[model samples]
Target: MVLDLLVVNPNSSRSMSDEIARSVAAVDAFRAFAFKTTYMTGPEGAPPQIDGEETSHQSCDACLPLLKDPESEYFYKRYDGILIGCFSDHPLVEALTCLTDAPPVVGLLNSSLSFVSLFPSGPSSVITSNKEWVEILDASVEKKFLTGEARARGLWKGTVSSNLQVLELHSEENFGKIVERIRRENVERLGSKYVILGCAGFSGLQYKLKKIFPEVIFVDPIILGFQTLLSSATFLKCQNV
Candidate 1:
C-alpha cells in the first residue's frame, strides 16, 4: 500500500523543482500515507517561468523529452501517478496521461481550482505573481473547472495586483511588501476569504502567510496537485482490486 509519486516541474530551474518537492514532502499527509515522492525539472531549454501561451508551449515541448529520459521513464513505469507542477495546466499533462493507461496525470491549475471550490465560502480570489497571468489563469479557471454545458462560472471573485515575476517570487527584493499588499488588497479590501497561489514558484508560501493572516485561507496549487495525484492513484488502485 505504498504510494510513489513524481512531480515534474515544467521549468529549467532545479531550484523551483526543489521548492515544490520540499513543500509537498513537509506535509503530514506524506508521512501518514507512506509516500515516496520524486521530482524532476524540465528540459534545459524551458523557461524559468511560463508567463503566457508561448512559454507554456515551450515548457510542454521541453517536458516531453525529459519524461522520456531513462530516469524519468523508470518513474513513469513504477510511480502511482505523475503531477505536473506548473500552475499553467501545461499540455504535458495530456501528453503524460496518454503515455499510460493506469497512472493518471494531474495538473496544479486544475486541482487547485477544484480544491478552491470545496471551501464553503463565496468571493475567493487568486493571487498570482505576474499581471500577464491574470487573464490566462482566469480563462483556465472558467474553461477547465467551471464550465458546464454552454455556460461558464468562474470561482475566483478577483485577482490581486501583484506585479512581481513568477521566478522572483521566493527571492524578490520587495517580497514582504508585495505580500502585505496582496493581503491588504485581496483579503481586506476585496472581501476574498481564500486566495489561490497562481504560480508554482509560490510553493511553501502558505506556511509563512498563514502565520500572519490566520483568518485568510491561502491555497498552494502544488500541494493540492500532489494530494490530488495521490488520491487519484489510490482510487485507481482500489478499482483494480
Candidate 2:
C-alpha cells in the first residue's frame, strides 16, 4: 500500500513549500510513498513570530481552511501523517493537531533537535532567520527536549543564535558571504560541533556551509522533517498490518 504524507507549510509562502517538496523528493525512502506538499494562504509572507509556539499555533490556525478545503481532497483523505514545515513547534503544532484529524503531527523544530541528539555532541547551535527568534527557539528547546536525564547528562550542548537577516541575504552574491560570516562568528567562535539551520531559507545553504566547514555537522530542517515523515509512515504501516 502507498502511504500518503502531506507536508504543510503553515505560513503563506508557496516558494518555501516548493523548496521543501523538492528536498523531500530527493529522499529515496519517499519513493514508495505518495507525498503531497501544500501551502497556507492566510498571511502573504512569513509570519513574524514563527519562532514562538503561540504565534506558530496561530499561524497554523489561520492556515487550516486551506488544508480542509475540498480542493485538497487527497491531502485530507489519503494522508496518513502531516508534517508542519515551520521551524517552531510550539503553539502552532499544538493548535494544528487539536483542530485537525491529522495524527502524528511533526514539526521541523522538534525533528531537527531530536536529530541533533543522535550526534556526538560537543556543542550544537540553531541558526535562525533573525535575532528576534532566538528567545523563542531557546524556550522551545528547554520546554520540549531539555528535561530529565537528558539535561543532566549534558548530551545537548551550546547556545542558540540568529543570523539577523536570513531572508534578505538569499541573493547569490550575499548568501555565501553571510553564511561564512555566521560560521565564523557563531559556530567557530563558540566552538560548536553541529549547527542546525533553523529556517527553510537556510536549507538552501547547507551545501555551501558543509564545504566551508567540512568537519562541522549542519542539520537541515527540511531534510530532518522529511526523514521524520518517512520514518513515521513506515512505522504506521507496520502497525496497520
Candidate 3:
C-alpha cells in the first residue's frame, strides 16, 4: 500500500517546498515505506520565511484558504495525511484539524518533540534562526506539553540560534556554511547530542550535518512530521483490514 502525503510549506517560496520534498525523499523510512508526496507553497503574499509569532500568524492566515481551495481540491480530497512544514506548531495545524473530513495534520515541531521523547538518552537541543525565535518556540513547547516537562524529561535541553535571518538559510550562498558552523558549535560546545532542526528553512541540512558531525543525531522536523503522518495513516489502514 502506498501512502499519499501532502506537505504544505506555509511560505511563498517554492524553494522551501522543494527542499522539504528533497529532505523527506532522502529519508530511509520513506524509501522503505513506499509513499508518494506532493509539495505546495503557501498562497501569494505569505512571508518568505516564518521567524517569530507574527510571521507564523501570517503564514497560517495565508495557508488556510489554499487547504480548502476549490481549485486545489486534491488538498482536501486526495491525501491520506498532511504535513505542515514549519518548525513551530503553527496555528495551521490546529485549524486544519477542525475542517470536515480533514486528514491528520502533522506539525513539525509537535512531531519532532514527540519523537525525541521516545529516546531520552541525552541532552536534546534545537537550532533555529535568529534570537527572537527563542521565546516563540520555547512557549510552543510549554503550551503543547506543559511547563518543565520538556526539560525535566531531557526532551529539550535548550535552543541555540544560527544568528541568520530565516529566509537566508535557504539561499544557496548561505545554506551550507551557515548550518555547518552553527551545528558545529551546538555539538562541540553546547553539548547537544540530539539536535532538532528548529527551522523548516533548514529542511535539507540534516544530510550534510550528519556527514560532518557523525556523532550527533540531527532531527529535522519536516522529516519527522512526514514519518509521523505516514506511520499513523498506515496503522489506521491496517485496523480497517
Candidate 4:
C-alpha cells in the first residue's frame, strides 16, 4: 500500500507554492516509500506572505478552520503524514498534534531543531529571509527548544537573516546576498557547521550553498520535514503488523 502526504504552504502566495513544488521535485528522498503527495496553498482568507507574528496568526486563522472543520475533506481523510511548510512555530502544529488524532505532522522549525538536537552536530544555526524573523524565530527557539535538559548541549547558536523578502529570493542578486550572509555571519564569525534554511521559500538552495560552503552542512527545512514525516510514518506502520 502506498502512503499519502499533504504538504501545506500555510500562506496564499501562488509563486511561493510553485517554488516549493519545484524544490520538492528536486529531491530523491520520496523514493524511499511508495507515496502519493498533494500540495495545497492557503485558501482565500490566508495571507499572501507570512512576514511577522501578525501575518503568521492570519495564515493560521485562515488554515486551521479548514483543517479541523467536520464538513471539510481534510478532517476525515487520514494521510500517512503531513508537512507544514512554515519555518516559524505556527500554532497549527500545536492544534493538530494535541487537539486531533492527526498522523505524524512535521513543522519545518521543529523538525530541523529536533534533528540537530538528536545528532548534536557541532554548532548549528538557521538562516531566515527578513529582519523580523531573526527575533521571532530566536524567541520561539529559546522558548521551546532551548530549555530544560536540552540547554546543556547548546546545539543552536542563533538565527540569522538576509534582510530580503520571500519573492526576492528568486533573483540572482538576492541569492548572492544569501551566500555572503552565510559566509560572513554563519561561517567566519559564528563558526557554524550546520545551518538550517529557515524559510519555506529556500527550497532549492542546498546544492548552490554546498558549492561555496563545501565543508559546512546546510539543512533545507522542507526536505528535512518531509524525511522526518516519512520516517515516522514508516515506523508507526511497522508497529501495527
Candidate 5:
C-alpha cells in the first residue's frame, strides 16, 4: 500500500492551500514516491490568515478539534506523518505531539531551522510576512537551533519581515515588493547568505527570487517540511514491515 501524508494549513485561505499544493506538485513531479498527499485547511471558524498570538490561538481552538476527533478523516493514525503547513513554529505542531498515537509531526519552521544548520557558514535569516512573526520566530530559533556553539558560530542570523499579510503574497504585483524586501533587508542589511521563506504563502516564489539574487540562497521551508515529514513517514512504514 502507498503511504499517505497529511498537510494541514491552520488558516481558512484556500488560495494559500492551493499555493502549497502547487509547490508540492512541482516537487512531487520531479520525485515521485509510493506516497500520496491530502491537503487540509482550517475550518470556517479559523481566521483567513494567522498574523500574531490572537489569530494563532483562534486557529488552535478551531482546528484542534478536527485533528483530535476520532471520527474525522484527519485523525492522526490515517497518515504516516503530518506536516503543519504554517511557516511558523505553529501551536498545532506541539499540540499534536501531546497525543501518544499521533504520527510524526513536523512544522515548516522546525524543518527549515534544521536544514539551515547543515550549512554552518549560513548567516541565514528568515523573510516572513509580518512584524509579529519576526519577534516570535527570532526568539524560537534562539531557543531551539541557536545553542551554545551554534550561537557562537553565528550560523543562524535571525528573521526579518516584509510587513505584508500572508494572503497578499499571491498578488503578482506584490512579488516585486517581496524580492525587494529580501534584497534590502535579508541580503544587504543583514548580509544573509541563506534566506528562508517563512510563510506558507511564499511558496513557489523561490525560483523567481533565485533569479533576482543569484548569489544568495532562498530556502522554501514548505518544501523542506514536506521532505522531512515524508522521510519520517517512510521510515515508520519500513519499521512496521
Candidate 6:
C-alpha cells in the first residue's frame, strides 16, 4: 500500500516548502511515501511569537479555515498521514485532525524530539535562526517523555540567533559556513549525539551536515514527522484487521 504524506507549511513561502521537499527526498526511508506540501495564506509568511500570545493565537486562527476546508481540492484523499512543518506545534494540527478525515497528524517538534530519543547517551542541541523560538523549543523538551533521559544523559542544549534572513540569501556561502562552524563547535564541546535543525528553512542543511559530521545524527523534524506519521498509519492499518 502507498502512504501519502502531506506536509503543511503554515506560511506562504514556497521556498520553505521546496526546502522541505528536498530534505525529504534525501531520506531513503520515505521512498515509498507519496509526499506533498501546501502553503497557508493569511499569516505574514512567518508565525509570530514575540508579538505576544494574542497575535500568535490570531495568526493560527487565520490559518484554520484554510486547514479545515476539506473540499478545497488540495486535500489528498490517498494521503495516509499529515505533517505540520512549523517549528512549534500549531493548534491547527489538532484542529485539523479532529475536523477532517485526514490521517494521523504529526507536529515537527514532537516527532523530532521522539526521534532524538532513539539516540545514544550524549547531549543534543537544536540549531535555530530565531533566538525567540528557543523558549518554545525548551518548553517542548520539558514536556517530552524523554526529558528524564535527556537530563540523565546531560545531552540537552538549545542555541538560537537573530540571523533568520541569512537562510533566504542562498548566495551567501559564508552564512552556511558560519552555521557549520557553530555546529562543529557545539558538538565538540558538548559531545552531542544528535542535532536538530529547528526551522523548516534549515531542512536542506541536514545532508550537508551529515556529510561533515558523519558520527553525529542530524534530526530534520519535517522528515522525522513524516516518517513517524507514515509508520503510525501502517501500524494502525494492520491492527484494524
Give me the candidate number with maximum lDDT.
5
* lDDT score of residue 5 within candidate 1: 84
Best by TM-score: 5
- Cα RMSD for candidates in order: 12.4, 12.0, 12.3, 12.7, 12.3, 12.4
lDDT of 5 at 63: 92
The residue-level lDDT of candidate 4 at 173 comes to: 79
Compute each candidate's TM-score over C-alphas.
Answer: 0.76, 0.72, 0.76, 0.81, 0.84, 0.68
Which pairs clash inside model 3?
Answer: none
Q: Native-vs-model 5 lDDT?
A: 0.85
Give the per-residue Cα lDDT of candidate 2 at 201: 68
Q: Tell how far residue 142 is off in model 2, in angstroms.
A: 0.8
In terms of lDDT, the poorest run of 10 residues in model 6 is: 45-54
Backbone clash total, candidate 6? 2
lDDT of each: 0.76, 0.68, 0.78, 0.83, 0.85, 0.64
Higher-lDDT candidate of 1 and 5: 5
lDDT tens digits by residue: candidate 4, 1-241: 9768777899999899999999767454434558777777888989888899999888888887887778876661457777889999987788788765678888999888887776565888888988999999999999886644446776568988988987687688788899999999988777788989989888889899999999898998998899898878876665564
Estimate the overall C-alpha local distance difference test score of candidate 1.
0.76
- Residue 184 of model 3, lDDT score: 68
In angstroms, how far off is 154's CA in candidate 1?
Answer: 7.6
Report model 2's TM-score to 2 decimal places. Answer: 0.72
lDDT digits (tens) for residues 1-241 of candidate 3: 9988888999999999999999777554433446788888877978988888898899888888777876875466477788888888689889888988887789888888887777767767788888888888877777784335556765566678888888887788877766665556677667778898888888888897788778888998877888899888765554454
By TM-score, the candidates rank as 5, 4, 3, 1, 2, 6
What does candidate 2's lDDT look like per residue over 1-241, in tens digits? 9999989999999999999998777566535565566544445433654545565666766666555665765244446667777677555456557754665678888888777776654667777776667877777789876545446666455444445454564667766666665667556676667788877767777887888788878888888888797788766665555
Candidate 5 on 15-97: residue-level lDDT in tens? 99999888667654334348879988999899999998789888988998998888999877687899998887689988999
Q: Write the per-residue lDDT of candidate 6 for residues 154-215, one digit (tens) a residue.
A: 76776444345424523356456545545665576556677777767677667867777888
